[model samples]
Every structure is written in structure tokens, then in C-alpha cells.
Target: MQELSNRTSAFTDSVIRRMTRISDQYGAVNLSQGFPDFDPPKEILTRLAEVSMEGPHQYATTWGAQNFREALAHKQEHFSGMKINPNTEIVVTCGSTEAMMAAMMAITNPGDKVIIFSPFYENYGADTILSGAEPIYVPLIPPEFNFDANVLEAAFKQGAKALILCNPSNPCGKVFTRKELQIIADLAIKYDAYVITDEVYEHIVYEPYEHIYMATLPGMRERTITCSSLSKTYSITGWRLGYVIALERIIDRVKKVHDFLTVGAAAPLMEAAAVGLDFGDNYYKELQNHYTHMRNLFLKGLDDIGLKYITPQGAYYVMVDVSEFRCKNDIEFCEWLAKEVKVGAVPGSTFFKENVNHLIRLHFAKRDETLQLALDNLSEIHIKAKKR
Candidate 1:
């Protein structure tokens, strides 16, 4: 029998979404995926209702809704300390997923090398493959999840055309310090390669550990492609709103790619979200405070449980050290954990190219009650693996 595309033979299904399914199978508390289990902002809902009644229900402008672009420019400039042109620097996309794909399509050619930090957000690997680019995996070594500057430079020396930077990173939750970002900027500048940054967690940072826009770094604005989303921020992951920002030249190319890929983000959703894009500073302050509370609650729980883990500086995830359990592999441990403990986690191997499996990632983007339930479930952990 003939098979499906061999291009995809190396890929398995998303472990994160698979965990969601497993949770369904067992009624487990799923901390595997990083999405909020709550309603989106009330204003966004209100605007969505109004948009549902009114009909621009058709396709928005191919690049984006004009209002959305304008709002995004304003918001980005305010945070980044760099003015962005609404007309030439932004493309609204389905999510950071599409924004990033558009970015890869815009800048990369087949066989180009793109550097990805290890234990990265999983989508990045698939993005590189499907975009026809080869990935150079650079180890952001564990515990503190810091990368050695010389090793990172080595990846660039190997003819990498771009690097995917995930600030306030997802699985490991390390916010690149300003000094660290400067070092990266210097490298990208020296290499003359593009910097594609995934900054969806821009506002989900903890106090005293702020997220720096890579594009805002000296000599980086024109060369950086920033992919960001409203998914995490507004608790509207399903709404699938995101955008790409670059210098006019890169945006010109990405807009063409995005046009063919998604033909613009959803029309009515984009229109409704323009209102959210303009939400006041208080909205962001409240967002940070809410995520801060969740971070504290979960990290404190891990501390009390005596779990060895990297304390996240930002983002909604924590990468825990599970070496004490004497696991054969992370996948087996995670499966045993789900069925036996009734709480799901993502095996750290899925995010790494190396043989390291001493880690597991969890999300705290749940309601307090839900958080408490998972914590309670984890409190009395006992796992003698059923299969291993």
C-alpha cells in the first residue's frame, strides 16, 4: 500500500494536544498544554457579540484589518519604544503559529539553516521542517536553562540564516535577561542573519523580570521578525489572533506569504480584537498580576512538594527536575504519571534533540481551583511504573 507523505515521516503528533486527549480518556487534570481554562476578556466578548450582529463577516483586508494593524502599531510602539508603521510593518495572522510560518516563508529558502534553542516551544521544529529549512539545535543547558555564548556563536558560524528566539520561553520559562539579549543581538548583527522572535508571553512576565523586544535592541529593529499573539494575553487562544512585525522590506515579503497562506486572519475577529488592542494600561497591569499569582501559586506548590525544578522567571510554565524518580525515559514517566497520578505533563524529550529526559513541563494557566486540584493530586506522588 502507498503511504502518506514521507516528508512527515519523522514527525509524531503534538505531545501537548495528545495529553489533552489522554486527559479526556482518563478525566485527568491536564497541565500539559499552555492555554487558559477560562473565558476571555469581557470587552473582547462584548465586541465579538457586536461584530457577530454586524456583518463584515466576510474576509478582512488580506494583510489585516486596518484598525487592527493601527492598534497593533500603537501597542507595540508603546512597549517596544520603537515606532512602527501600521501600513508597512504588520500583518495580522491566525495565531503566532501563522505569523511565524509567514515569517519563515518570507525569509527562508529551502535548505537554509535556522538555529533553534533546545527545549524550545515545539511548533518551531515543525515550522523549520515544513518550511524546508534545516534546524541547528543549540543547547540551552538545563537547571537555569542558560546558553553559553560561545556555543550559540558556533551555531551562527555554521551558516545559519536565521534564529528563532523565544523570550520568556514556553517550556522552560526563562526570560532572556536584557544583557543576554544584547549578546544575541550582537551575534545576529555580526552574522547578518534574521532574528525571528516568538513573544506571545510578552506580558506574562514576573515582577523585576521584564520581557525585552528583540527588535528594540540596537541594530535589530530592521532585521528582526517579531511574531506575537493575543491568545495568551486575552485568554482567547481559540480566537487565534496574532501578527508579524518587521521592517517594511520583510513585512512586504511576509505579507505576500501570509496572503497566500491564510489570506489574512479572521475578519470579524480581527475587527473585534482591535478594541482589545487598545485596552488601557490597566488591562495589562491586571494581566501581569493575574499571571504572577498563578506563577507564585504553582511554583510555591512545587517548592513545598520538594520538587527540584527551574523557577520560571516569566511565562506560565515550569520545567521540573524528575531525576529523583529514576525514570527510564520521560515519555514512560509522563504516561505513568497521567494514569497513576491523574495529572498530565509533557515529557522534556519531545522538546529536545539531545538524550536528556530528566525534565517535564507543566502549565499553570488554570483557574485557582483547577491549580489547587492538580497540586493536590501531585502532593502525594507515588509512581512505580506499570509498563516500564
Candidate 2:
């Protein structure tokens, strides 16, 4: 075969998914993929069981189930202070994965330029490529992942059509401050470009820090296309429920693309997830507490082992600098880590458009025992590992 499609050449298999396979192979404690190992809230499971027998078992409206969309609209309004018309501005898709794809298709054209912050979630690379848009990667400098306003403004000045903002970003796990979001909002408004946001970790922020929805910014509501999922918030990653909130005009276009991409999200899962969306404020606060404890516990373990890593402010991942330990190739190091150390991590190279590879990424979304097991294994990183 000469080639299957131009899109197929853009990326290899997702490194995060590959880490999961390696974790199983070596019987390693898996803290690579960002999914909660514990069971989702029991209410969702019971609701799902009820819905399966009850007959919305068939296809939902191509956009979304009515109840799910309505619930989502209310939840989003409560959090972001923006009123969304469920019928016009929302589309329920299989996951934020599909929502992102539909959004890219809705907004981008061939050869168009889309600016993305580097050290991005690996999916953003493939999404831009498959949508036939060229990505202009603006590097988010290390430790503290922040971008320069001038640098961002320059990307827009060069005819970029959209900027993909991943708040509470994956891999690096830095949440954008409200002031930072305002800067991006200013640039998008200045250039008349769209802002496609991935905010799946919206509710997972550490205390005192808050998740500011990009759409909530002045003039941003009409221009921002928000793609988020129930996967992170509800701990139901397998359920594959996500939605997009956009201006009605953009939603109309995204709905058309989404209708063909996934047809609709799974009906029963949608019905069950509605329970999660309408959950009380205390539920989210508790979720934050759980994650905060995990973050501190995991960091404590890392500290004891003398590992250097960024402290995550939001999301469940941290990217550790592996250069000091003399790891030349991250892929080889991660393989060694899995087979020998019995711990799995994703090579950070795959997440970058820049060519620096002195790091690897890990997630902290496991039971306390599992985190301890990984930490215990990682303690020996300095012992058996070769030093530069």
C-alpha cells in the first residue's frame, strides 16, 4: 500500500495508550493513562442498569439526548456563569475526543494555521493534522508552564485561524490563570479567530486555585468552542460521554460534522451521566479533596526518592525532568522503567513539537496503595539506573 490516507502519516499510536499495554505486560503499577482505577460513582452504575432495560437503548437525537444536554447546560451555567441554550449550542458526542474532532472540522480549512501550546496533550497534534490544518506550536516554558503574550500575539499575526487552549492542561498539568486567559481572549478577538478549548479537568483543581472557563471571558463566549468530557469529572472514562458548547452558528456546523462522526453518544451512558452533571456542589468539592490528597501523597513519595518534578496545580499528571539522570532516549528509558522498575510512564517527547526530550510524563490517578507501589518501585531509579 502506497499510503492509506494523508492523516495516517501524521502521528504514530498514542503514547499514553502504549504505556497502558506496557504496564500490563510487566505487571507494573499503571499510573500512565489518566483514568481513575477505582469504580465510578455508584449512582451512575445503577442508573445505567435501569436505562439499559428501559428502552432509550436505541439511538439518541444525533446531537445528543435531550435530558443529557439539558443537564449539561445547567451544570455549565452553574460553573461558568454563562447561560447556554441546550437545544442550539450543545452537541453530545462519544467523548471530548469526538467533540474536538468535530470542532476542528467545523472551524478549520486546509492549510489553515492553528496555534497550540507545546507540551500539549498528544491528541491535539493528531486532531490538527487530520483536520488538514498546520499547527503553529508556541512553547510553554518549563517548570511553570506559561506563554509570553507577544509570542502568542505573533502566532495570530501570522494568519492563524484558531488557537487550541488546553486549560488545566494534560501531561504538564498547569491551569491557566484568569489573567492568562484574558490575554489569549484579547488576541483571539484582535485577530478574529476561534478559541478551541479542552477543559476536561475543570473540576480537578487544587483548593484556592480555580478553573476559569475560557468562554466566560468578555467577548470569548461567542468565539470560544469548549470541548470537555464526563470522563474526568465523573470518573467514567469508559463511558465516553463529552459535549461541546459553542455559539449557535458554530454549534450548527459542529453538529453536522458530529452527526456523521459518532452519530450520537451512547444513549444509556448519556442517561446515566446526567446524574453526574446534576450532582451537588459538595460532590465537586469532595472530588477536589480526593485529588488533592492523591497529589500530595504522590508528591511526597517522589520527594522522598529525590526526584525532580513539577508540582501539578490541576489535572492528575506531572512531567518529570529525566535529563539529570542521563536518560538519553525517553522511549528506551520508559521501556526499561516498565520492564525493570515495574512502573509505566509515557515518554514526554511524543507530546512536544519542540525537540527537547529530557523528560517523561506520569499520571497520579490510582488508589493510595497503587501510588505507594509505584513510588516504592521508583525509589530504585537512582540505584540500578545508569548515570550520565
Q: What is the C-alpha local distance difference test score of each model? A: 0.89, 0.90
> TM-score of model 2 relative to the true fold?
0.98
Our model 1 lands, by Cα RMSD against the true structure, at 1.6
Over 141-163, each residue of candidate 2 has an lDDT whose tens digit, in order, gives 88888898999999999999999
Each candidate's TM vs. the true structure?
A: 0.96, 0.98
Off by over 4 Å in 2: 386-388
Show the colliding residue pairs in model 2.
none
Worst 10 residues of 2 by lDDT: 1-10
What local lDDT score does residue 146 receive in model 2, on the 0 to 100 scale?
A: 88
Residue 120 miss distance in model 1 (angstroms): 0.7
lDDT of 2: 0.90
